[model samples]
Target: MSSLYDLAGPADAGAPGPSDPSDPSDPSGARDVVAFARVAAAAGLGARWPGQVALLGPGAAGAAAGSLLGGAVEPASLDLSAVLDRSAAGGLVDVEFDDAAAVRAGLACGGRASILVQPIGALPPEVLSALAHRRPTAVLTRLDDPALPTRAPAPPGDPAYGDPDSPDSLARSLLERGEPADAVAETASGRMLVSVYVPAPHLVVVGSGALATALGAQLALLGWSSAEVTGLDDALAAVDALGPGDGVLMVDHSADVDGPVLARALRGGVGYVAALGSRRTQAARRERLRAIGVDEASIERLRGPAGLDIGSRTPAEIAVAIVAEMLSVRASTSGAALRDTTGHLNAGRP
Candidate 1:
């Protein structure tokens, strides 16, 4: 069987051609969804087929495949030839894997998983757009009515899913927890499969120095992306372009460069905004920001002195600490050590 990457197209094709968006180097996985949507559209799957095509994998890992679009499922290990044929006909199939079979299927463990091989017409265009843009999104599928699933952007203030009185409030809560995994949620209406998709964290590093270089390398090692900028225009543009799952790190201590960028990021929806400075420098920066009319609430969102107190003196060490803090913030955790905490270590993790 051919991998989805193989069937999609070349990874590095020239502009205007379909290419493998599932390339490992992309990090965000947004490319995968975009490419799948493009390919599906090109093949006339949406028009020829009764409904939209997509894949829904099983477990908290969230592996799913559909008529032509593959979600998180690896198309290589599981022979999808038969599944694809069935999905093209708008048929639903429940695929279960034994322990050994699961291993062969590239799953971490084995269990009965009902892969949704149906039309995804119910999914909104906005949801798909959010996924393609590397924004947080959730797909809530009612187990009883699996054919017509609903979607919502996973940000806290989104009106579509944020109302506590909504039937899928439980699913919204799961999504708000910021866990990028599949979960079974019992709602007021029925049981639902909440599949949360979060883009890999991207950071805007505002400065060029040994510290900035180290941070870039560190982000790459973590399967994340970072862009370095020094000019105020570039810095502001990057900060403005950030989504709820991305961040900006102002490593340049210059007030002229850092002030406007920090104000923009703090007021915007960027998930994390941090800066590299000493305690005194942080105080000075705050005063400068306040003088420039930045509100107290927005200024408080800044994670100045950027990283955890990990005794990181070297540039590389600082990068590790900063990245660790960023992950902790993304996960909505206190950055405490596992030993110091009393709950399941892997709880809410994929």
Candidate 2:
């Protein structure tokens, strides 16, 4: 393992870090990444949490941050790919791009790019933790003498990264968008990259059968946290947890078991609400909801026979289809085939 200096300022030793940076057990920063990810995931980091990547240093050159936006560990492929095809192998570069294609794709607001690309695993534990739990986190990397470090240090106090209480905190300002606040600001240390990671929307799965079980498992694989509601009580309780970035799914076989929960979830203004069943079953359920005074608008919000037209057969496959549709709703995509779709693959990321 390569040894290097600290990239971020020194933080207090008592902060909520996964591993002690000064520990002798793992000096290579390997254990901290694993430990931080483990703790953050356990704390309910939403599925859409992007990777923790930081681009630090004075403006210089040819690197794109597309990977950072998509939560990938590596840097993005720059438009100047022909110039420095292997420059990023070391993860730090100072080349300039010919066009702002990468910026248009969703990155820091500029065409001129020169920065040290910090690996996602090397992000500070505080930033990583905030990202894991969907807390709004602003990564302020000092760029005076930018250097990639083998060990990423937690930033010392000043601008609170994830502190919700501070009015001037970037966390408060970054709440307006789900995607990163791609911009650069002049800081005391020099130019800094201010990338914000907002929490992904929550998915609440209602029911207690094999479908629900498969749904929960599938969501976990996506790094998303979901609440499983098996009864009216659980469903009502889950409504309190619903926010603008949350949705609900009904998978129970009985309307008696799924209707009340679905009604409450829809009324709560969740982003997506879907129920599994056949088309005929959906129509019957719609009428039943109408009889209960669910109204046309609310009834319109419900997506019965949930999931895309993937012809899925098993519970696991159905779960995939449903999640796919939910993802499409979140991305504002038509849920159409990618081949049929035009434009950048990562457009409209939130």
Candidate 3:
């Protein structure tokens, strides 16, 4: 199914200018939401407008909405023809999907969705900038009141959170979860749609080998980004810049090089810190870290011998296992088989 990652720019002349969300021209050179925002901005939908531009809400099965610029939806797969037909004059459109309809629409489950189909812009420049720059951003929309302006995406310090029942407070709550997700909330103003966009998982690979090459391929396949660094200074810089959603994979197998980088990552906000080594190597590395003043609590965060017990041997297979483990860690799961567990299949998914 077409996802946000598969969105392409319009090809026809006079249509919204063509844009590749994964273009290398991006400053980060990573395929992220910033590229998506660039597409919307290039199409002239990032600002307030009274023209024919509209927005399709709840992007990717009610995760977040994307702009419908020049009659093209940036990141939508659902058949919005009926909704668009009804909202041709530019207004609000709410859509509800039953189990069968939702499944047909490529949604994982059935639910009701409210899509804002008006020419009125949904995102302000500040909000777009935050998303483009990989900052934690939350977009709040009043579904019931199209006349009311959509609240700008804000960080946790915004005064809008002063009101408990305000949409901004609800958005802040979602942002605090530190994961990208969207939901509908009951606010004092009315029913509001809040979507949180966080930095995509950026992995720092601190080694060079077949494994590193395989890891890069896997990261690209997942639409995530990675930086390959060998120097201790570059590695440390990458770890220090990592956000809560980012990660580090150390495969250099050098105690002197790995200890400081791993220590900094564990002590900082980097979400996943892993290393490649055997049992003896892991123990020796731990001791080295201790000698360097890394606390026990911080050291415990290291996932030495990275990757699940998938009995992988080849570089590609090991890469799969490592990437799988990284995803499990991100989801707060135990890398267990679905048949071996209970409850929702996607319970831990962001």
Collision count for each candidate, in order: 8, 11, 2
Per-candidate TM-scores read 0.64, 0.50, 0.60
Candidate 3 lDDT (Cα, whole model)? 0.61
TM-score of 3: 0.60
265-330 in candidate 3: lDDT tens per residue?
888867889999899999998998999999998888899899999999999999998899999888
Flag the better candidate by TM-score, 1 or 3: 1
- Compared with the true structure, what per-residue lDDT tens digits does model 2 show for residues 11-37? 111122343333424323322321111
Q: Pick the candidate with the highest lDDT.
A: 3
188-293 per-residue lDDT for model 1 (tens digits):
7776655555566789898888988888899988757788887888788667556677888888988898888898888777888999888999999899889889
The residue ranges of model 1 lying beyond 4 angstroms of the native Cα positions read: 1-73, 76-101, 104-112, 117-122, 129-135, 142-167, 184-191, 220-223, 331-350
Worst 10 residues of 3 by lDDT: 8-17
The CA lDDT of each predicted structure is: 0.60, 0.52, 0.61
Tell me how far the alpha carbon of residue 175 in candidate 3 is from the true structure, in angstroms, after superposition: 3.3
Greater-lDDT candidate between 1 and 2:
1
